[model samples]
Target chain A: MKKINYNRELCDFCGTCVSVCPQDAIELSENNLEITDKCTVCMNCVYICPLRALEVKNEG
Target chain B: MKDRYDVIVVGGGPSGSMAAMFAARAGVSVLMLEKDREIGLPVRCAEGVGDKGLRSVVDINPNWIAQKITTVKLISPAGMEVVIGTDEVGYILNRKMFDPGLAELAAQAGSEIITKAYVNGLLLDNNKVTGVRVRTLGREFQVKASIVIGADGVESRVGRWAGIKTWEKLNDMETCAQVTAQNINVQQDAIHLYFSNTRAPKGYLWVFPKGNGLANVGIGISGEASRHKSPFAYLFEFLQTNFPQAAIITTVAGGVPCAREPEKIVANGLMLVGDAARQVNPVSGGGIVTGMIAGKIAGQVAGQAIIDGKTDEKRLAEYARLWQKAEGKKHKVFYKLKEFVYNMSDKDLDDTAKIALQIPQDKRTILQLFKTALVQKPALILEAIKVLT
Candidate 1:
């Protein structure tokens, strides 16, 4: 299973991934992006990035 | 023998009806199931749609229209209004009649419509959808079909049951409450949008006139800050101040998904359309056009598959491919854009409004406006600027 590896370092603090995630899996804490347990790998943020910052990691 | 049809469309909304209509015209037997006893009763919409989006399919019928609009007025958070001059090219549809009328058109095209039929589950065979189990009129029955389309709106359970990942985050969803009130003093020719933070924190409020002193007054706020208070509470506050003299006629409350793209609407042997697919506009919370377009494509693919006798996941991947080919890139881009725009601070919005107000009325191209408001990569902004313009 591939998991999303959110690069907090590169994130623009725009919350695009947070709003586009259908599962409400992403939250913003003090301008830092937090990936929650509810994530279902929708990839809405991965695809919706204007900055191309968020990445995904698949687990074997 | 178990019964079977070419396509089983769940939800008799416009998209489902259009799907059934197109598939039936392609010579496939179609069955449309609507949970509501009345197909278009208790209307739930701002009732406005762009003219270009409607012209692609059916001509705008006069009977279905409440008003034909020609101008739009956008107000900023600071109460500064900018009236744009575009070809007045939209209609406030009388959904009560228009919705049922579209279903009737589907029936005329040889599709069978079953109202009051609530689909409770999807019948799966060998990990693939084969039919649906529905309860209606105090009885339960099952119907088999080659293709199943989930056209049920915003909070669709069918997509979830089929493992399509239909969840919407609280912050991404816009809780909406609207009402059509009579005896109001509002501009009948132009739509009014209020963008003040005091009115809506994460979203905006709108007043769409339906002619003859009637208008649909509504507001939507992002679900993130709206956890404690209901959408009705927010809308009531606005109504009390703005339209205090207006008589209340009807009220509607629902959630609108503002996500740029849905998780996945297409899977092996199944597809979703309309609000179920989250095909709505990211900014406006409008889905009528996008849903209709998706339905047309899904209908075409389903028809061709039935003719070829290949309704499996591999074969149905074409629909997914075609959808992405048609609007996937735009959806991806819009998702990012929506996030950036929604995150704009009140000060940012105020400054942007100042810039917009400075531009001469004729010089307001969407590109110039977005660029002036945003300080992001030109490529993404340019792409979005071109698409919206």
Candidate 2:
């Protein structure tokens, strides 16, 4: 179960994830976006995202 | 062991208090926490609320109001003023007093509220939100709740703690600074908006009256434009040249996100309301009414979910559905419209304003004004007509 997942290649670096995530799990660190905490995998960010930058991936 | 709460309301702003009040009204065990020693300290809003929009949720209290406005005077960059008249424009509230009054209303509605308490994060059990860990006065404690309502404002931490995306892009945010001042020359009852790309690119300056030659004058510039100078710097220059005699009484500087909506507003047993959810208007940057509206919907749905004994993501998503259905469609349209509007050049804006002033005042519908501003074809105008009419 990949607890934290995002495609940096796809992210527009919009910071939409920073404002909407409830856990404060996602933040732009060192100008590179990183998902800090293991997200609930709710897909709220992936779904509501206008750019479709993030998604849930199985943590193998 | 402390008492269990049916709903834990965090951040004792208007939205939080409203959530606590509505939840407690349903006979639920509600607890509201305010980090500040006193609620509504360091006020951060223009305090304007439309009469009709506000009446949809709570009744108006005469004592809470500061000034009753009937007209809005909009000024273009070249100083062309357009007056919009309405029977019930809005009231510029005394928010320092009004915010606490809302919390008092929640208390009166049987909700227990504590001041000087900060919520650290959510207590998760089996990946479901169960409670919150709070730190108050150097002491840490945990409180369990069946449901958690995050009424935190623009810089909401609770939303992030629960795993909801609370990030706002720079383009979607307006850096604003306002001041309450005296000796203002603007009309007493008319709210004024000064639009100039040079003054506030991607945003506008506002002069809202506070009665008796006093007013709250402010300006918001989008972050992209603000790279050259801060909103405070731009506003001070404007005031020095325009209203140099005015004496400042108080100042408020903050960020207002212009999101069509937040990245997400719901997750499992948690929900974000008010500015936390990015429900502020895309154009005017007003959030009080929309926040309260979304708060009522979120609180009502959260309370029902608690009574039903289920607080999962699917169950709580009703809050999101309710809010989206409330104004989501308009927001989508506004987002698209904002992109188009902001892309206009300074000369384009001045020219558009000149053309708009040519429209007969009585025929100045929103559609007509928009058409004048943008050289849209009849098809686009018709599309807008269908949606608006």
Tell me how candidate 2 scores on lDDT.
0.76
Q: Model 1, B1-389: lDDT tens per residue? A: 13688899998888888888888888999999987778887576788898888778666678999988887877777767777657648888899988898899889999998887878789888878888988777788888998998887765757766777766666667767788998768779888877755567677889899999999998877776564454567677888877888788887655677775656776656888887888877777788877887887888888889899998878877877887887667676666666656766666667777787788876765556677676533435655564465
Report the lDDT of model 1 for residue B238.
81
The true-structure Cα RMSD of candidate 1 reads 9.9
Query: Which parts of model 1 have CA positions greater than 4 angstroms off?
Result: A1-60, B375-389
Candidate 2 regions exceeding 4 Å error are A1-60, B1-3, B85-87, B376-389
Ten residues in a row with the worst lDDT in model 2 chain B? B376-385
TM-score of each: 0.82, 0.83
Instruction: For residues B286-361, write the lDDT of model 2, one tens digit per residue.
Output: 8888888887887788778888988888998998888889966776777666665665566666776677677766
The interface RMSD value for candidate 1 stands at 13.6
**What is the Å distance of residue B134 in model 2 from its true position?**
0.9
Q: Identify the candidate with maximal DockQ.
A: 2
Clashes of 1: 6
